[model samples]
Target: MTEAEKFTEYTIPRKDTVYCVEFCGTETSSQLLAVGSNSKVSIYLCKFREEEEVEEFEYEQLHDLQNGCRVTALSWSPETSITCLPRNIRLAAGGSDHRIQIFHSDLRGNDSVMVLEGHTDFVNSLTFDPETGDRLASVGDDKWCRIWDKDGNQELTFPLSAQGMSVCWHREEPVKVMVAQKNGVIKIFSLSGQMQLMSFDTNQVPLMEADWCVGNKGLLIGAVAGSDWVMFDVSVSSRPVERRQIHVEGTRYFRWAKCHDSLVASVGRPGRQIKVFNAKSSQTPITLSQTVTYGLSWHQKLPALATGGDQKVHIYMFDSL
Candidate 1:
């Protein structure tokens, strides 16, 4: 690895296998992130201090809530766009108990929790509408995609062709959402009419993940299936316009940079190694060959990445990945 590929990692003090991690994408919540390990999920406020001598990253534990079960997925509400001490924020977490927990915190220790129960099996993924933040979408082993309002009421439930793996909303068109299945089928749903807008297949079995390109305003689709990552231009074709092998062992997930059209990241098995690539040039300049990793995410604005393995949540800043 070159010097630039060597990541400057800042570790959180928590010690446990981090199963899921998500950086808050809401406006003022840029300094916030959630780390789920064991049976608890903790939110932290990060601060960077620069001095003439050195620079450091400081962390403040805001809310540590009991999950009642292992957390499978996490999503931050878009309404958490304020920076204040007495701040009220919402976070939606899917748990192994097959329930959706909406944690309403006010920067205080207490939590007003609302549990949305419908999934008859493990909840694999959960996401909040980035535009309105008033709706939550989830996919699960039950082979169903459930949509709920922030108030915990079920608004819609659609049957998936197979076990749901991942789901995310289009950043540009909030009413449109994408759902990926373990059977390799990817579908875009229009919530306005509760209808299918588009559908395609990876051709490779067991699709692992799918994410909308927020940096590209959701015009592009990115997914990894059977160790191969593919990109689709929704306006152009039903099949991937670009495809490349990212991991030989198997890809666990693929995430697009929140603010860059060219940057992408993924974690795969055998060693749980993480790699960052440029989608435009088909180049992977930086790769982290870690032993074990469960979660990976990017900063809302910067090229920074936060990943969990061992016991800590480590953050990597590109600064000038």
Candidate 2:
């Protein structure tokens, strides 16, 4: 009858607090999971196996890597291929040291990781371009959004009006990208000409994070600013179409479900209480309280939500209705 009772839950125990969670899917069948924590990033291969008539999700540790510093944000590169037997995977992780590390691993004993030197402040977020995983987009407290190629070369840099909070690639637009600044301004850019396409302001100042909707062709964008989360319809208005408060002190993270257009997840500070809400609804359907939590991520295909907790990674699958 209860929201949490109608779902299945999975947990991964770690030695330290998890700061971020990212799921990567492969054509070979299994899914790869990346969880970032203190000075290390743990990678796992996850899959759903049918036990009796019920489907059960399972994961196996594939890598326990030393990141050289506390990882704050992470993104999976599009170059990952699991169609062959060896299974090659690439992941980019940003650390507290204000650097980005690219981890290239495979089953064939050719595992190499490289550090990307950029951003004078702590890296806040990073995402690989959806069209070609070769390019990586990132934002940080350094007031810049920088792009890097697969070879670890910094190719482009875009100065921000404030501390850059989040950056993401448009899933549908091959050359479109977005950057959310802490001053509550959101800018959309065209990668082809490296020209600013559009810019909009949130309902309030101090935006913490923002995400692009998957179901919309980069039309709808969501962000967490101040104590409220707002959604912007770029094609319709220069302002947010929806804005509501879920956090009292402040909201930290905001993520739209990759598989669903109207579903979203957010983390509020003060207590780190996470909420799952429908875009059109005022009431949140599910809430999880983790006094000390860091990030929120949605499963690549399934209707599952994952979050980082104190020394653990928690995954939940609930009926969005």
Candidate 3:
């Protein structure tokens, strides 16, 4: 590993085996939400400082999804977007039932806002357009990417040849959604009035996760099953501008830090390591953990990280820059 690939400091005892991790909150107070296969969700609240210990909170019983459906994906509403209110912010999750469920968080508690049903196969992933909170996208094993209004109305549907695992909105454009399929292809299409622009045959490996970086100038897509991750300069071309292949120790989960341009985290392999990388270089990844990690997430505002794998959820603060 090169100098930049060497992370400075890290927290100990990383998360155990987890199903998913999400970063929530506005630009100020941030929190990490993790979902476990054991039919529970864990919430960790803390300040971001690197390498320091952080206070943590865990919500193991997410009574919202009553049927015990696993949370396949998560998203937060834009603070300024009128699509959802502060207390009325919405979270969308898909699962084995082929349904998309929305949970509303309020001063009273978290409750099911609505359940979207239509897909004929397992619902795999969901993406909310931060630019236009009204629009949301979902992909599934049925090989179709569907767009829905926040109110649960169907907008559009695009068919692909591979299983759709993840989808994301372009930073500079709200109407455009980038759909990642298991066959290693990323399709970009508009979800505004009609299905405007569409592109296919984007990749050759199965894509497990797709995320937009800090300002949307770049996009990160990963296929942890194959230990391959790629970065794209949105303004340039459909081809990835950079790519990296890391040899993870075990079954991997690939994710980019929520609000950071240079940090990506994953839990898998030899010892459940949290590997961090600079997107600009795609060099040898730096291992950042001393324990097994199942899932990890970055805070939107603070420099801290929240991870959950074992029976305990941990919050770690980065001591300094």
* Candidate topping TM-score: 1
The C-alpha stretches of model 1 lying farther than 4 A from their native spots are 1-6, 49-54, 319-321
Per-residue C-alpha lDDT of model 1 across residues 1-321, encoded as one tens digit per residue: 574545577888576789899999975777788988779889888775431133577778877888988899999988885477668778888898888899888866657889998999999888999887889999999999989986889998889999999999877888878999999899988899998888988888779888888866577888889888888988888988898888888898889988788788888866877888889985555777766677778888667789887777878866434
Cα misplacement distance, residue 64 of candidate 1 (Å): 0.3
The best-first sequence of candidates by TM-score reads 1, 2, 3
Tell how far residue 9 is off in model 2, in angstroms: 2.3
| Overall lDDT per candidate, in order of appearance | 0.83, 0.83, 0.58
TM-score of 3: 0.76
Q: Can you write out model 3's per-residue Cα lDDT over 1-321, one digit (the tens) per residue?
A: 443333233332324345555666455324434344444444433333332354442332323334366655556655422223444445676766687776665524645557788789987777677665677788889999888876898878888778887777756666677777777666677665555364433354545655556555544443443466666655567676665656443335666665566666655556666666656663555556545454556776655566655545555544333
Model 2 TM-score is 0.94
Deviating ranges (above 4 Å) for candidate 2: 25-30, 49-55
Q: Which wins on TM-score, candidate 1 or candidate 3?
A: 1
Where is model 3 more than 4 Å wrong at Cα? 1-18, 32-37, 40-44, 48-67, 79-86, 196-203, 216-225, 248-251, 267-271, 282-284, 288-296, 314-321
Score every model by TM-score. Answer: 0.94, 0.94, 0.76
lDDT by residue for model 2 (1-321), tens: 786675677888888888888887433332778999888888887775432233677778877778978998999887787767677778899999999998888846678898899789989999998767889999999999898887888888888999999998876887878999999999998777888889989857789999989778778999999999999999998877888887888999899987778889889866888888889776655777776777888876777778888978888877544
